[model samples]
Target: MHQWRTWHRPLVLFAAAMAVMTVVSGVGLLVDDRVLTGAAIWSKPFKFAVSFVVYALALAWMLTLVTRGRRTGWWAGTVVALSSFAEMAIITAQVVRGKRSHFNHATPFDESLFNAMAVTVVVLWAGTLLIAILLLRARIADRASAWAIRSGVSLALVGAGFGFLMTQPTKEQRAAGNLDTADVIGAHAVGVPDGGPSMPLTGWSTTGGDLRIPHFVGMHALQLLPLFLLAVTALAPRFVRLRDPRVRLRLVQVASGAYAAVTALVTWQALRGRPLIHPDGATLTAAALTLAATAAGTYGALRTGSGAHTSPSAEKELVS
Candidate 1:
């Protein structure tokens, strides 16, 4: 119980709440088989609920890196938790009503709910941005952890920025004279309408591009980078001797950069109405270059041992 309480800081407790929501959403899927936008009515809620679990946990873990302004962490966590919960509640309500949560303002009531959801999302975004700024400005004991946290938050912001593009009217929508009105906000799929052919379960476009792909990939950078470092720390000592912490840190940096590059490529592909499965030569070349750069960075770090050093306090933090 003490361990649970100790770990269940504001953000962590919010994550626990999200976990409960995830289970409830899963139950909703079994009980409510209604379909919306070519998917199960409960699908959006389930995805968002599970996503909040990740988001809350990531924020909770990252908040520990803040050496100053602990109260700021609490305030930020509360803002994020409340805003996210409100967004989910709105989405679930719409789903229960058998209506689309996003891009739907057919009625005044629907419009009000949609607007509320949008505002909550904006508040959540602002809170996350503030947390990222705090992490970036914070002085940590561990250089590797700091690098991961900063890079992850920076990439998350980039991912969130893509939401604006999703909100913009697509070329087809614009060509069809369907501007951003009260009835329709924006579309998600490119080159084809959203309810068209899609991959099962995920609903990503199988025939066309999906802007959400990049956004989804980029948003998880917070988990990916830090987890990568943690995995390296766990595995390196056992597999290899003379493993320098700096090299591991450098590798994490390279991986983060490569991850961001791939995200950008996918976003570009989606914007161009090109499907991810059908990448052009330019896209392939870009991907190869990113991998090559990552390899080169790793090799340089290993050979030169020129990565930033971690402080003693930071090393202890990493261990804990």
Candidate 2:
């Protein structure tokens, strides 16, 4: 119980609650056949609930880094939790009403809800940005862990910027004069019209580009980068002989750079109205270059560590 309390902070507890809600909402999805905006109404709640799990966990993990201003961490976590819950509540309510949660200003009530959601998201983004800055400024003892935390939050900020981009009117919508007719004028789909044919469960557009793809990928960097470093730290001792902490840090840095590059490439592809699976020659070339660079960096790290002796303390730290 003490260990659980040590690991599960307020943000983590909030995440656990969201996870339970996500499971319940997922069950609701199984029963509801009713479709809204070309997808099940229950899908919104399920997705948001699941996303909250990620957000809360990331926030909790970040808060652990701040040695000072623990109170500030708690306050930031509380604000984020409340804002996220409000956003989820509004989305769930819209789903219950059988209406779209985002970009649906058709009715006065919906418009108000939409505005409220917008405000909540902005507040959430601001709070997240503050936390990211705090983490970046903190002096962590572990170099690899520090790198991971810094890169994750920085990349997450880039992802949050994409959310604002998603709120702008798409080219198609602007061309069709949807801005005049619709109360809220924005879309997730880039090249194709919104609510078109989508992938099975994710609802990502199958026929055209989707901005949400990059947004989702980018936002999750907060979770992905740190988890990746942890996994590398755990597996490196058993699988490989290279045990230098600096090498491990360099590898993670390379991986973070690769992730950011890929996120940018996907966002560029979507903005150009190109689907992810159907990448053009230029996109393919860019991807190949990014992979090659990452591979080269990893190879260099390994080569540099080939003859270097691992310190007992460093090895212990890596294993821990």
Predicted model with the maximum lDDT: 2
Count the clashes in each prediction. Answer: 2, 0
Model 1 misplaced stretches (Cα beyond 4 Å): 1-8, 178-182, 305-320
TM-score of each: 0.90, 0.93
Where is model 2 more than 4 Å wrong at Cα? Answer: 1-4, 178-180, 313-320
How accurate locally is residue 311 in candidate 1, as Cα lDDT from 0 to 100?
64
Candidate 1 lDDT tens digits, 1-320: 23344442767777888798889989988998898777888888888888889978888777766767767866887798889889888998898788898878688898889889889988888989988888877887667778888999889878877876777777777777745354766778888888877777677887788888888888889788888888877887674421555667777778888888888989988887777778889888988888888889877766644354556665565534
Question: Per-residue alpha-carbon lDDT of model 2 for 1-320, expressed as tens digits?
Answer: 23345542667877887898898889889998999878887887888788889878877867877777767767877888888888888988887788888988798898889889999999888888888877877879878888888898888878877888878887767777757667667888887888888888789887788888888888899999999988887887785643577678888888899999999999988888888778899899999999999999888876766786778886677645
